[model samples]
Target: METVMGNGNGQATSGGRAANAPHSDLVLPYGDQRNDGVVQVSFTLPVAAGPLAEEAARQTMKLMGLEDPQVAEATAIGEEFTFFVGYGKLTRAVELSKLRVAAPMWEELDQAAVNQLVQDTLGRPMVVVGAATGSDAHTVGLDAILNYKGFAGNRGLEAYSAFKVVNMGSQVPNEELVAKARELGADAILVSQVVTERNVHLANLTNLVELLEAEGLRDQVVLVVGGPRITHALAIELGYDAGFGPSTRPQDVASYLAQEVSRRMLN
Candidate 1:
């Protein structure tokens, strides 16, 4: 006898239960029933909200592989922009067990532990210089990691006695960031890019790498990037040590730096 359980979809599926254990194989976007393939998407178009705009939204959804697309809501923003919410069937399944991602191998330690490790191993404060570089003038992400008052009430790197943090603020150029990092003899460089329009972040980040390599400083420091769209794999591909996404706390970055510094310099 197999016991049934309610998955994200409202269906009570045994799902090939073995010893009362649910199988983790193929998965679909659940709406109200198992394998229903329901999904909701939101987007903005540069057209005013009206009957034509509603039709456009539905047609766009269809082009995106959605079937039986229904425009749930359409609203006009100011005068020229239209925001749309649409629902449809995705009809796609992915093997959850087959998917792979780059996972962090280091352990995250608290402020005291990190400080002690740095002091005992390096005998000096680890210097980190961070900024929001390029035309991306957003500083919220950079500030959250470097400012003493961190995001979500977590203490920033400044709280760690073994770290010397220098937050260069927003709109810093790649040249200046690299120069400052070189000047400070920084052990790590953190860059936050919020604007990803036309994949500009890629260009900016790559340019920084090229500059660092030209200056012969690429291998000497840990380079990390963070933003809403960044991922660990993407960062590694773009010549960075690591990447962080939204809601990343200061402690998270600090802990990674501590372990990474020890790994790079101590060992």
Candidate 2:
């Protein structure tokens, strides 16, 4: 059975979460002390709220392999629905050695530096087209990176002098985005996917890649994707050159584009 969370759009999932599960070079969640394996988990059950629901939640934690399960809170949401917040300790930890790590010796350039780099490399403004493609209606992420006002006080791509940006807004079709990129001879394409329900972002992003390939324009542009759940590794797997997740500043992406476009031009 699926559990709804956060605006009733998210479905609670379980995988044994190998990334967080214990293995070699164990790493455990810390709440009070290091390696305490303390964790807080929240979920909803179809049982009515009360003492029974809290007990059920604690047992559920035990079934999840959590030790010392404590049902912190239980509240009734519906006639037969109860939301629970539980605290527990895991008997295991995640292995650090199995993860990918990178240490790039490059710094994110400022807006001025980004413009200078583009001017120095291409001798003209770089055309970059961006959109919240497919049925993704959330434009906050896209606007934050592309609008001149920026996000969290950092300036955006539109503020960069060397960038010719065309933000196509939200719900843009994959074909329309490709056509716009081709139409503008874009040097880069930035796609934002805020909706990932049931891994829809994966299919949408993959379709964009296929479209770019079909149009024979994949090699001609730097493809970038960003969102809350996006990762560089996942983006690479989806055929994107780069991916920016949550809390990524616009300058960070601008620096990457500056460096990538510059390197491509020199090549």
The candidate scoring highest on TM-score is: 2
Kindly list the per-residue Cα lDDT of model 1 for residues 146-251, writing each as its tens digit: 8888889998888788889999999999999999999999999999999999999999999999999999999999899999998876887888888888888888
Considering every candidate listed, which one attains the maximal lDDT? 2
RMSD of 2: 8.6
lDDT of 2 by residue, 107-161 (tens): 5677789899999999899999999999999999999999999899998999999
Model 1: CA > 4 A from native: 1-22, 33-35, 44-57, 74-83
Q: Clashing residue pairs, candidate 2?
A: 22-93
Instruction: Provide the global lDDT of candidate 1 against the true structure.
Output: 0.84
Q: What value does the lDDT take at residue 189 in candidate 2?
A: 99
TM-score of each: 0.78, 0.83
Pull out the clashing pairs in model 1: none
Clash totals, every prediction: 0, 1
Off by over 4 Å in 2: 1-26, 101-106
RMSD of each: 8.2, 8.6
